[model samples]
Target: MFKSGFVSIVGRPNVGKSTLMNYIMGEKLSIVSNKPQTTRNNIQTIKTTDDYQMVFVDTPGIHKPKHKLGEYMVNSAKDSTKDVDLILFLTNPDGELGKGDSFILESLKGKQCPIFLVLNKVDEFTQDKVAETLSKYSKAFEFDEIIPISAIKGKNVDTLLKLMVDKLPEGPKYYPDDMITDVQERFVVSEIVREKALRCLRDEVPHGIAVDIIRMKKNEKGIYHIEADIICEKDSHKGIIIGKNGAVLKKIGETSRYELERFLRTKVMLKLWVKVRKEWRDNNNLLKELGYKNVK
Candidate 1:
């Protein structure tokens, strides 16, 4: 019988959730960074084969909320578990599992679906350490399975995919084989710009920032003319984003345009402006306007 299902990836921040999704899709359907809470939305990426289709939902890493945006992120992550066929609770094997992992596990108490404790970044750990991690989590929770994987190195990812497919029940294909993601191109573009900013800036600047696409249009020559504003929480952060003589902003634009062009498969004329929003993360209305709605 044909099999298909939704798989929700849930975990604490920076657990390689996005990396695992990208590796499965074989494309950059979700953005990744060393920063925690890098993914703010529940991104649905589709992987199809001749036999079955698996739709993977990449959620924001769960964390204690310090602002309205953070609250929305955590809710989005939790709500994604509502009807999924499987839950891939990712953990970084290089680090010790602690209260955060426990918190996520507690939240999944009533979930009826099979839960897999995926030990990611296993390439960084020794075999004994991997065995110990398996034993530790096995004792903590009665997971359906404990799978060791390296999201970066592509180790055991295919095995995990096969196991997930086996767990799926017979169902109709929800999306076409050629369709990779449900997110709009505009959203992807905004994320690309935000990823660039996150990689370029340091410290509080990246966390306190959001990218808004003000305009995106194609000219007569078929090249995309795009304009976006980088929103920051403070005026001082604005100056840092622009840098000395507009160098930093220029770099962000150059790198973003390069990637945007590759994604769009055409030339792009990109312009960026930095604006101060004065702690927009704490503002509920502003957070909603930025598309960070409370999922529940």
Candidate 2:
């Protein structure tokens, strides 16, 4: 008999949830950065084999909502926990369990599926430290399994996957073997642009930024032509994105184009423009336009 199920990786921000998904999928289906809340959507990644298939949901980190966008992210994260075969509650090994973890656990209070306390970044800790941390978390919650792993280094990740597969029930495959994620090409391209911007900019600029793909088409010459706009909350943020003599914007475009070409496996001509939309995060229409719609 074959086994198949969905697993949600829910946690606080900057805890390697995206990294773990990318590693398991063997592809970059979600964007990653040092910035918290980088993942704004619930991305479903499918891993299929001859015997078993696992659908993994990568969610935004649970946090306090300061705006409509924040509320959307938090809601998206919480909603992912409703129906899943397992929950991989990821947390940084060095950080102590705090209010964010408590809040997320509260949200999962009545979930029927088993919760796995995944301690990521174990490469930085010794065996004794890992044991101590495991013991500390064991008292906080009754996790079905408390597994330590180094997502970046691929340490014991296969074991985690095997454990999940063992717990999955018999079912049919939910997605094709060749398919990795459910996200659209345009959305992934937009995320690539946003990730590049986050890598290039600093301070409050990245937080206020959103990428909109105005147009994307393939020319007869077999090259993809893409035009995008970088939306910001203030004129000063726009200036920072544009940079002195347009150097920063040029770098962002070039870097984004490089990644897009690699991901698409074709030549890409990327055009970018920065626009100031004051208080876009709080604007419901703008949030919906950016695909951060709140749960109704």
Candidate 3:
């Protein structure tokens, strides 16, 4: 019989949820960084075969809300847990489980589906430590299964997948075989630009930034031309992005262009512009316009 279902990957920030999803999907369907809250929205990555199709929902990290954006992210993560067939709760092996992890676990205590406790970054843990960590988490909740994995090193990831598939109920495929993710091409392009911006900028700058793809087209010569605007909240921020002699913006453009070309598998001509949106985060209308609404 075939098996298929939605599996939500929920965890504390920087615990490697996105990295695991990208590894499972065999593609970079979501962006990754050393920064926390890099993933702000729910991303669905589909892994399809002839018999089974597992739709994995990669969610924003669960954390205390510091702003409207943070609230949205936390809510997004929680929403995924309520309806999934299984919840893969990730924890960092190198760090102790703190209030944040406890908060998430308490929230999930009432969830209907089974909880799969995944200890990520196992490459950083010793065999004895891995066993001890697993025992500690097992005491927190009666998890359906506990697997130690290193999402970056591909360690025990296959075993986790096999166990997950084994528990899924019989069902038909939900998406096509070649389909990897549900996000649109425009959203992908915008996120690509945002990812580059996040990599280039530091501290609060990445947090204040959002990217919108204004135009994308292809010429007869088979070159893809794209233009996007990077929205920032302050003129000082804009100045930093633009850099002296416009060097910083140039670097962002060049780096983003290379990635876009590689993703699209074609030549890419990208133009980037930065604009000040003036405290757009606090402006509900602006936030909604930028697609940040939906938090209650």
- What is the TM-score (0 to 1) of candidate 2? 0.97
Candidate 1 residue-wise lDDT, 1-296, digit = tens: 88999999999989899999999888987999998889999999998888999999999999998887888888989989999999999997654668989899989987899999999999888988888778878888989988999999999998998889889989999998899999999999999999999988887788899998999999999999999999999889999999999999999999999999999999999999999999898887777777776632
The runs of at least 3 residues in candidate 2 whose Cα sits more than 4 Å from the true structure, single-residue gaps closed, are 126-129, 294-296
Pairs that collide, model 1: none
RMSD of each: 1.3, 1.3, 1.6
The C-alpha stretches of model 1 lying farther than 4 A from their native spots are: 294-296
Stretch of 10 with least lDDT, candidate 1: 287-296
Candidate 3, residue 178: the lDDT equals: 84
Residue-wise C-alpha lDDT for candidate 2, range 115-216, written one tens digit per residue: 999999898877777777677678878899888999999999999988898899999988888988888999999999999999999868887889999999
Per-residue error (Å), model 2, residue 158: 0.8
Q: Which of 1 and 3 is the better model by lDDT?
A: 1
Give the best candidate by lDDT.
1
lDDT of candidate 3 over 1-296, digit per residue (tens) = 89999999999989999999999988998999887888989999999877688999999999887777788888988889877898999997653657888888899997888889999998888877877777777888889998889999999999999999998889878888888888888788888888888888867788788887888999999899999999999999999999899988998999999999989999999999999998776666767776776855
Question: How accurate locally is residue 159 in candidate 3, as Cα lDDT from 0 to 100?
Answer: 99
Ranking by lDDT: 1, 2, 3
Q: How many residue pairs clash in each candidate?
A: 0, 0, 0
